[model samples]
Target: MPAEKISSLDDPRVYKFTLQKDKELARDQEIIVDSPKVVLRMMDAGRTPKAILANQKFLDDHGQRFEGMDCQVYWADVPLLEKIVGHRLHHGVIALAERPESLKLSALGHRLLVLNGVNKAENVGTIVRTCDALGVDSLLVDERTLSPFIRRAIRVSMGSIFRIKVRTSADLFSDLQTLRTSGYQVLGTGIAPDTHRFDKIDFAKKCALIIGSEGFGMDSALVGLCDAVIKIPMRDHVDSLNASVAAGILLQRLGAI
Candidate 1:
C-alpha cells in the first residue's frame, strides 16, 4: 500500500511511529531510520518500512524511491514534522523499519570481531562500518555492548549496520572460550608480556579479534583467556588508541586474508 498522507502532528499513528523519547521502545520489532540517505539504504538492502514521515517537499523530491514500497508515507510540514520527532528531521524524512534477525555464531565465517565492554554507540557504529569496509566476516558483541540499531549509531555508521552480520552473546567470556576450542585463536587487543605486534599476526587461521571498552581495557579474565594479546606499535609515549580506531587497524590487517 502507498503511504497515507497525514498533516496532523497529533495523529495517533504519528505518535506511535515517532517514539523519539523512547528510542528503544520497540527495538526488538522495529527500528527508526532518520535521513533520506539511510532510509534509501534500508530500502535498497530489502528492508521494508512500516511507515515513513516526511514533508511534502521531501516526498515530491524523493518519493519515487518508495514508488512500489508497501508502506505508509505520512506527509507533514517541516515544522510540524520537527515538532513531532523532537529534532530537525534530516532532509525531512524518518522511517520505521522492521528490525533484521540476529545472526548466529555458528553461521559466521572464520574471521570475526568480539566486542567485550564497548558501550559507546558511535564507537559501535564506527566499528561496524570499519568491519564492513575491511571485510570482517561478522561481529560478536557482549551484553554490555550498545545496540548498533540505535539512531545515532546507525547515523554514524552511514547505514553500514544493515550490511553487517551482528550477533550478541549473553556470556562473552564463555563464547570466547568456545571459539578457542573451535580452532579460532582468540586474540585480545591489549598490551601484555606476550602481546604480539599487530603486524606480526598470522591471518591464515581462523581467529576472533577482541576489542574492549574505552575507559577500562579488557578485564583480566578476558585477557587471560586470549590465545594471544595483540598490540599496535606506538611511539611518542601514546599509551593507547581509541577502541574504534584500534578495531579499524586490526580489522584491516587481519581481514586481509
Candidate 2:
C-alpha cells in the first residue's frame, strides 16, 4: 500500500500517534513502536500494525515489506512528524498496533520470567532484551508491574517485546501455582535463610523465575509460594543490584549463556 500523507495533526487517524503522558498511553491497549529498525523488527515478528505513520525515507527503504499488509500507511515531513509526536524523529518512523491476544498461562513457553513488582519501564525493557538474548520463552508481568508496551520500554527493549510472548497476568500467584502443578518449578529471586545460590540452582528443566521490584523485595506471599528462592552472591558491601542488572546476571545463568 502506498503511504498516505499526514498533513494535519488534527487528522483523526494520527491522534493515536501523537504524544501523550506515559500514564495515559500505558492505559491504552495499543502499542506504539518508533524507529524504523524497531518497526521492521516488529513486522518480522509477524505483528501486523493497525496503521503506520512515517517519513519517505522509511518508505523508500522498507515499503516492500508492507506489500500485502492490510493496514493504513501515512507519511509526513520530519518537522510536521515531530510536531505530531511532540519529539524529534531520530528514526523518522512509528507504527501503531493493537495489543495481540495473549496465550493462556498454561500455554506459555517452558522457560518464563515473571515480573512480580518490578515497575521500571527501562528495567522491563532491558529484561525484555535480556530474555530475547538468553532464551527465556516468555515474560509474565504481575498486576503490580508496569506495562511493557510503554514507548520507553519498546525503545529500551529494541523491539524484542514484539518477538517475545508477554502477558500481563491478572493473578500471578495462582498462575505460578498452576505452573508448579504442571511440573514447572517456580523460582523467585531474593536472599533468605533458605535461598540457594543462583549459580547452584538447576535450570536445566522447565522453570519460571520471578524478579521483584527495585526498592522492596518480592511480596512475602509470593516468596512463600516459590519452589525455591535464589540469590546472586555478591560482595558484602553491596546490598543489592539494579533490577535490570540482577535480571541480566540471573538470566545468563538461567539460559546457561
Every model: Cα RMSD to truth: 1.9, 1.8
lDDT of 2 by residue, 132-218 (tens): 999886888887887788888898999999878887889888898888889888889886657889888787478888899989978
Q: Give lDDT tens digits, candidate 1, residues 79-127.
A: 8888888877767788887877677678777889888889888899899
TM-score of 2: 0.94
Minimum summed lDDT over a 10-residue window in model 2 is located at 19-28
Error of 2 at 224 (Å): 1.8
Q: Give me the runs in candidate 2 sitting further than 4 Å from their true place.
A: 22-28
For each candidate, the alpha-carbon lDDT, in order, equals 0.81, 0.85
The alpha-carbon deviation from the true structure for residue 241 of candidate 2, after best TM-score superposition, in angstroms, is: 0.5
By lDDT, who's the top model here?
2
Sequence-dependent TM-score of model 1: 0.92
